[model samples]
Target: MRYTLRQIEYFIATAETGSITLASERVNISQPSISTAIAHLEQELDTQLFVRRHAQGLTLTPAGKALLVEAKRLVEHAQQLYEVASEANDKIRGQLTLGCMVTLAPMIMPELSHAFTSAFPSTKVMQVVGDHDTLLQKLASAEIDVAITYDLHVPEGFDFVPLASLPPHVLVGEIHPFARLSAVTVKDIASEPLLLLDLPISREYFLAIFMQEGLTPHIAARSPHQDILRTMVANGYGYTLANVRPRSDTAMDGRKVVRVRLAGDHRPMVIGLVSPKERRKSRLIELFENHCRNRISDAYIPGMVAPVMEKRIRLD
Candidate 1:
């Protein structure tokens, strides 16, 4: 009943890894320290939580296994309590977790997280990056407090506050003929080799554009990493369809690239903040949310090419 949060954390680490040495490495503590914490947890709970074997590490006893779930829940609740506590007074000082879609992570996280932390030096923002489905799962499990993701198949009971619209664009190398055009239609690239970003939800999102046009892209390359896809396109492997335009036009290898608006009336992906519909706002979360609203907009997104309404936005 009086066990400390640290003890529970160490206990969870040990339970998860099944070995004191592994837990020690995972939690950045000494093996003996973890062992002591586990012992303390067992003594407090008045039950043997782990069944230690001679050389096989440890396994949770039935009682221990049952308690593991509660221990995890308790630890998570403790974290939420800390975030919702006295620190909420004035000087916002607590940890805030933000989940971002994988494709946007490269262009968004570093700048956004750094700016939030820099603005509120007392606060720390931990970022988790995943594809759309993974971000949705994480948000549901309360693993991340909020998410910056596209409004793609967002389920019922979650609130999505749209921040900016990122219309899909055709990505080509500087020397590619399509790069010279102000815009290109889906038919223009249907036969051209495609560099597909093969991430969940995103793949379907891109392919559906061609589907709507009753065309199938001739995919020549696929990558999950945005940088890799850009590099492939820059090397003439194939052109790609992308929405998050990184500020740099050059690929990882320094070859220049171009973004041509994918012409016609196409549905643009809207980036937004997603969270549980009824979760009360935490000051830290609210601050970060407001920061995102200010940072990303109809006209601007940090570390990304601004909207080129009249071709003023530069990817470089």
Candidate 2:
């Protein structure tokens, strides 16, 4: 025996209204047609679906209650299918999933959130934060619509759009001797204890800077959380080298920590927008990416923009 979607819709309508006359009016069919459809459905399932009496309307039997649950679900799924099809034919209004690297999440997310929400009020935006490799995997699997991250050794199936360059700077404890200086040379940092950011790509970049200067940093502590390294530096634990500056104004407590320019030609970090190469461009993603590019360009300063020509190796 086979049941049809129209039969399920009639079943749900009758269950909701409790009167064959009202259900018929709601479904825009004759009352006898509604009754016949319900009778046919009950016969197909070999169960009594309704208990009827004179002028008392109808009540569901135990079997009727169970069938009603499945009937409602089927109707809902059918409606959802229609809604999805209609939305696909129209503009972007569904949910959009995005991912970003941990460091970039703090610095650029606020602006992106405000702009995207204001422009596309109906669209729902969901964000996931992870390291570069993890986000890359998600983007490739279509789990995320796009990713914003540092321009590292990107995988082959991804296309990158250069957004901005965050030059490397030295963060020193406010109480540290060098904090009083406006800027310090490689010789000064090379002799001091260094707190490393410990992220694979960032660590490699910093180590390369020292190698280029013909010196080795005295390593003290390593951390993945930038805030932890900042707090440690605030207490004069040690200094760290970072490319992205903190967007917040606290500066790790208004005192006890400061950022100073690092000497020598350390390669600047290239930050950019990343997305899967094969995926069709989404309007929402394009809007957000354009906002990022505009914000970065407006904030650009001569000698501060890191060139994208830096070479990197894929660690994964």
Candidate 3:
């Protein structure tokens, strides 16, 4: 039973996208090629890997699930080997795939990209934006080198380092009553219609605000797209809860959205850099990680902000 690394790569891609067509598009290969590779992999392993449906996408069988863990390990080992060989030649020229949440991507990526590029001109960086779960899956599979996101449930066998602490702020349409308030409290927000950022960790974090106040919020809508949520709040559809405050210059266009500090003791969101603990680090990954850490430390002053909530909020 000889399964090639290319087969594993295609399988992981299909697993991530859930559609052979989409996966092929992502990897820039033909759908028939991907399908053939998957079929060949199943034959070599002597198990049916995926259960296909007519309308829906494929789901991994038990055999597929078991093989995924080994596949990721194999891929990571191969990546580490490639990195070592590249460094042996005294060149840092290679791909650096990074994962980030939608919120942080817009604010921090510009500076990060510029600084990293200036320092390591040879390395090519690729950014993938997704929620926590999606990013973690990619990280585990060696598809992405690192992840930048809010510190949520840190899985076993992963290392995390804090980057910045963001304080929770209230976002309201200009016409909303709370927009006139100097500062608002969790209790005050309980009765208002709220548009929650529906990212995995964010949904839990925002809803936990209500739990802390011992009340359930009047949730208006939940979505993963930041733009959609922002537009919803800006158009007077509902208010939103966010840790990162909107920059004053970009706060409002014609939509008339205003950001206000939350009253009382609030939970600070700690965004961090995460990578697999068991995997051996390359010089490139180490250099990029250190640069990010230094930039974050210089940007955020700890005494100015409180610590994040220690309790984990379960959305599921």
Relative to the true structure, how large is the alpha-carbon lDDT of every model?
Answer: 0.86, 0.74, 0.78
Model 1 per-residue lDDT tens digits across residues 1-316 = 6788898878877887799997887667998999889888888889999899978999999998898889878876776676766465657777787999988887888999999899889888877778999888878867689999999789998999999888899999998999889889999999999999999888999999999999989999888888898988899888999988787789999999998888898888999999988877777888899999999887878778767532564433
Model 3 lDDT per residue over 1-316, tens place: 4878888989988986789998897677999999999999988878998999969999888888888878877877786776887788876655577888777787677778677888778776777888888888888877788998778777997898987777688888888888888788888888889888988878898888788879999988988877677778888888888866444413434576777668777677778999999877788888889888876642542222222321111111
**What lDDT does candidate 1 reach at residue 151?**
93
* C-alpha root-mean-square deviation, each candidate: 4.1, 14.8, 7.0
List runs of model 1 lying over 4 Å from the truth: 1-3, 10-65, 80-88, 308-310, 314-316
What TM-score do all the candidates reach, one by one? 0.82, 0.65, 0.74
C-alpha lDDT of candidate 1 relative to the true structure: 0.86
What's the number of clashes in each of the models? 0, 1, 0
Indicate whether candidate 2 or candidate 3 has the larger TM-score.
3
Considering only N, C-alpha and C atoms within 3 Å, which residue pairs clash in candidate 2?
A: 174-256
Which of candidates 1 and 2 reaches a greater lDDT? 1
Query: Which tens-of-lDDT digit does each residue in 188-256 have in candidate 2?
Result: 889788999888677888888888888999999999988788888887888998876663424555555
lDDT at position 67, candidate 3? 86
CA deviation > 4 Å runs, candidate 3: 1-12, 28-54, 57-78, 248-254, 297-316
Q: Highest TM-score, which number?
A: 1
